[model samples]
Target: MAKIKALKCKECGREYPVEPLHVCEFCFGPLEVEYDYDEIKKNISRDKIKKGPVSLWRYVDLLPVENPTVGLNAGFTPLVKAENLGKELGLNNLYIKDDSVNHPTLSFKDRVVAVALSKAKEFGFDTAACASTGNLANSVSALAASAGMNCYVFIPSNLETNKIIGSLVFNPVVVAVDGNYDDVNRLSSEVANEFGWAFVNINLRPFYSEGSKTLAFEVAEQLGWKTPDAVVAPLASGSLYTKIWKGFNEFKKVGILEENEKMPRMYGAQALGCSPIYKAFKEGRDWITPEKPDTIAKSIAIGNPADGPYAVKVTRESNGDMEVATNEEIIEGIKLLARTEGIFTETAGGTTIAVLKKFAEKGVFDKDEVVVAYITGNGYKTMEVLEGHLNKPIHIKPTLAEFKEKVVGQTINK
Candidate 1:
């Protein structure tokens, strides 16, 4: 396998050899994967990609890993043209990249972890780990177990039971940290140093984030190798948004497809409970002010998102908008997308759908423009939250009179 060019710090542009590291020693800025794109371009072709598996592995040349991996069947998520939802939003061309149904674990994080673990293997690491709000832990454990690697998963102590079970099913060493996700992250950074494990999000992040680029790649490829006019996605740590933008730009740089028109307008969504990025964007602040998250969208409840500043800059540079929705609005948005399109998304997806609705209502979304909205996780992880909100029928002792009142010619359960 060809060697990766090197790792480069995003802020200071300092370079390091491929290693189990994440931060720059000089400026303390985040480090990211750097590659010899010219080499990748020479080897990558549409026909070559077509012969690969129907997963994100098809874009392995563009990803961080040099070898093929058989992790979760990540990527190549459905790109359904939302004609019905488009009409509802008074738009002509809208698409939903429904990652809610992605592979074994059923979340977009599987895509990233696939590449991260592959890198971990290349680096000769044995143990796999992550500090997750929810989905990342689930992906890490499942992928690690499959690779015959021991795993340690850390998460917020108050996570949803379904999410906890999702990771535990893979039988990892799960730790419920006694605080919010931020607290869990700090602990993981420390633990990563003490324990020589491949913590995917902390140590293997530069490569991990490359997995998200596939979402953007697949979207463009599925749309006949063309870039969309706009994209809307939920922003947590902002990695997804940034990687997506990188994917599209990389496509242009490679000349695999070329359109000299405007780059897509990148919109970001956030639950109002933790919307420091959106607030910073709106207020025209240079740095994001962190906040304590308190929302049902626990997946995206990062108080101090690592990529917050980059997210704001990317959104603004693309002539896009960032919007936040209340928790009530998020629930309604979840129901709306599910009711309209049969896509049962978690709260993070709800945030995207809510933002899409908001922007559409405000006439920000052009009817003629091609738009793609990413739904990152399934609602199954959050189904418990829906219980008791919508009621079960109260039986009159299961009597015939109950049917007459409740089921017979009922309108709105009259």
Candidate 2:
């Protein structure tokens, strides 16, 4: 009655014992943790989950770890009923899965790092590491420090300044590579091989990716055990997007969701400057052609996504579409979410919001259809992206006369 069966290859269906492995020897395809869902069904139920801890670990029956020791407080972020945002978008049933406040790191990466590091510890690894754009770096640094493990995080040199500081404060050895995210990942792979460090997204990826399924689990439970009609989530390496789709299906497989409930259509969002998944989806192709990263949304600016093909497959299977947003549109999307829902999200979230708007405008959703848009990180990490795009503050003195003339007068005129 083992919860996890093996690390099964995504292609060629090869199976290997659970270890810090991510690729198949025979096919070189990615490996994923295969579970014994029938065993899970006998042990899991709504009441069991409800009585568990109020965190991602509450769904421990589904995650790849047996005892999750890192990022204990991560996940179970708020699923806000976006009444204001819904009205603005002309949709009545819209929600925002706000992971901007996810514990320890303030991003969805916390969930994955939690599982990854926990599994790494179980595998007798002393060091935790990852190649990141921003959020993953911050998560690995913070969580690994909390777990008392030696940590190293690699990221592109040009990542946002605040993100670099976010990792630095956690005291992990941070490596700033001289290229884009893909380059950083390549270096991390070599380092993981050379040093035998548990790179969370590399050698430990089969376990790390399972953490993202908790987002889907939380959303379904939060929505009263019903899956949404559609979901719009940002795509970086496309892991999060595909895992979310997997989560909903898993719930159904475990009998947690009602037999009458339907799966959600999965919409993938990307920035116009780097949109290999969107390009592949639109052109009716199944494979991704890598693009050079060139977007303000640096977090989701992956040129070559490891899970890009799976993401496209899920989108097509779910009857969903992929879309990209320009820098201008991404900025507006951030502002719109802030103004309407009071949620200040990073560029990744802005990309999601913008694509959600496009889906709404294109009549992709009915008026009463349930839609959930994921906001993955806090805007504070990437505030520089909004520079000169927001209005300058009204520089009024302590005088009420100046306030009335410069602020109140202008307010009234507008």
Candidate 3:
């Protein structure tokens, strides 16, 4: 096995032995798994990674699990050149990491859930559970079923129909809170402590979030071992943004890629209805207050993001700005991407596209730089958001005259 180290607090810097714990007892802040980089550098190499499976397991040396008991073919997704969307946005070089088609489940949540469940099994946990908005529930339920662990998922009652069925299909015990996500999450934390279930994003969070680093790992490697000039992704708990940055730095530290003068700019996108992070960033606040989330992009509608400050720090430190898109703009973004790239993104992905446009218009991206936007979830999961927005095809009599009349002077919406 590789050199197993300890978990360290991100706030007060206290360290603890590796376990299924997420908070530092001394400081009450979040904990993250830490490794001896010097040891990792000595053992990991290009050939070592190349010999592994074609999934996120390729970077197993840096992950938290000592033994991965169960997982799917997660990560190593395609980095597609968005020639059509790029031309529409007037960018010469642009790409899309479309994890909307990610395996084992549709959304990118599979990455984090896979890591969390593997760690849960490593710790000998019998049940896996979480407090989720949508996609995480689906991932936890399905992964728990595959791993033969009893599963329990808590969520708000207002979640999309498909999101509800997605988890229920796995036969997990699904609990719906009458209130919003924050309410359910608060209750879940208390329940997790009381019942000792392996709440993936809570108790096993320190290890679970390491899965997101693969987003950066794959991007850099797919770009011929170089990082892009910029990356735009939706912000929920803010962990994803920070993990992606950490992944690239880890690769550079281990000699898989040499440290260079260039680094990718990280942009965080949020919906206007639940944009506490963006509001805090604009107001120069150091801390964030949790809110009752209300937005079309329910998947990215985290009000009191656990990693909000860290996300802002990374964005500002990288010379990037955070922005929020209106509900209308989010819908337009969904249509824009669908029309140009044939990718039907949900509201969270729409928030990314909408923010990309806002920043692009503000000169945040150079037309020649390699820019990549992450599409995290499929729109089919929330098709209700687009229902009745388009006109039904006109039923014409069995006559060519009626068909020509309906088509005449009516230019295609495309």
Candidate 4:
């Protein structure tokens, strides 16, 4: 009668009880939440989802939680049609699943933290913590504040100024490690073990990662109960990308989607500076080779992604591909989306858009195929990346003549 069956290892198929564990002792592989799809199929239906709350909790039956009490207002972000962006990309059906305005943190991290913290409360934890690149720190700090739990966030010392301030504003204990994300993660693991606190990405990762499936659930429900033809998402630890693949498949498995509907071709996007997954995919390898982080897209600059192999597996099995974009291309991608669709996204989203453009140019997507590009974080948190790239504001005297001569005149001259 339980909602979930057990925590099963992805490699050895070993199972453990529902607890704060993420690894299998037998194979040293990652563990995932196993559910009863037959029971879920009997309970979930289209009519039930339509009548549920507007947040991600609408798919609570699919997630790894019970009696959710955190992030009540999170999820249910807009799936914009993106007509202007679609025209520029030469694709007829392009949608932008914008999580830039996600509740509390303005990033998709809120989704995972929401589920993680809620489950942490259920497990009677008084503190919520995480190792973050940027957005996850903000999410944990803000959401933990809302849940009235003591919060600690660890991040690289060189993270963006705005992101640091974002977490500080929530009054959490923020630690800045003198290294990249992987290094910070190593230290956080030690801290989690010592403190016995609920490290969202460490001990509660199975529940945390399950939250990302809501993005796919919302996308399907918004698209009239159908899946997109293709999905291009930014990859960091690769959890989001792989979970989305799982989400769509789970929908089919639970009988939410029509029998004829198929999973989308999953495309993984990454910055050329830290593109381990991209390299692995290109080499046709089922494993990942770690790289050093050196890109403006810091949010997705994980040198050693924990879920890199699984992301590669999803892309291959779904007949998908991966691509990387240069720093210059990433900036242009941000500018293009802003100009075309009026969405200001961070470098991670920029990387995704740049790769989407490349795939469009290569004629990878059919003209009528429905493609969705996920914009995960708001650009305001990463404004420094666009400092010298964006056009400067024109200055003039406070007069109508000056406005016409400087602004209107320049526009007409062009």
Tens digit per residue, CA lDDT, model 1, 1-414:
453688999999999888888999999899998888788878888788889889999988888887856474788999998888899999899999999988868999999999999989998999999999999999998899889999999999999999999999999999999999999999999999899999999889888888999998899889988989999999999999989999999877776677584479999999999998999899998688888999989999999998999999999899999999988888888888988899999999989999999999999977999999999999989987677656587555677877777667474556
User: In angstroms, how far off is 295's CA in candidate 1?
Assistant: 1.1
Per-residue alpha-carbon lDDT of model 2 for 171-251, expressed as tens digits?
A: 999999999999999999899889989999999999999999999999999999999999999999999999999999999
Give the Cα lDDT of each candidate. 0.90, 0.95, 0.88, 0.94
Worst ten in a row by lDDT for model 2: 405-414
Q: Residue by residue across 218-288, what tens digits does model 4's lDDT show?
A: 99999999999999999999999999999999999999999889899999999999999999999989889
TM-score on alpha carbons, each prediction: 0.96, 0.99, 0.96, 0.99
Better of 1 and 4 by lDDT: 4
Q: Where does candidate 3 have its weakest 10-residue lDDT segment?
A: 405-414
Model 3 root-mean-square deviation: 1.8
Q: Which stretches of candidate 3 lie over 4 Å from their true place?
A: 396-414
Candidate 3's TM-score:
0.96
lDDT of 3 by residue, 277-324 (tens): 888888888788777787989998888898999888888878788999
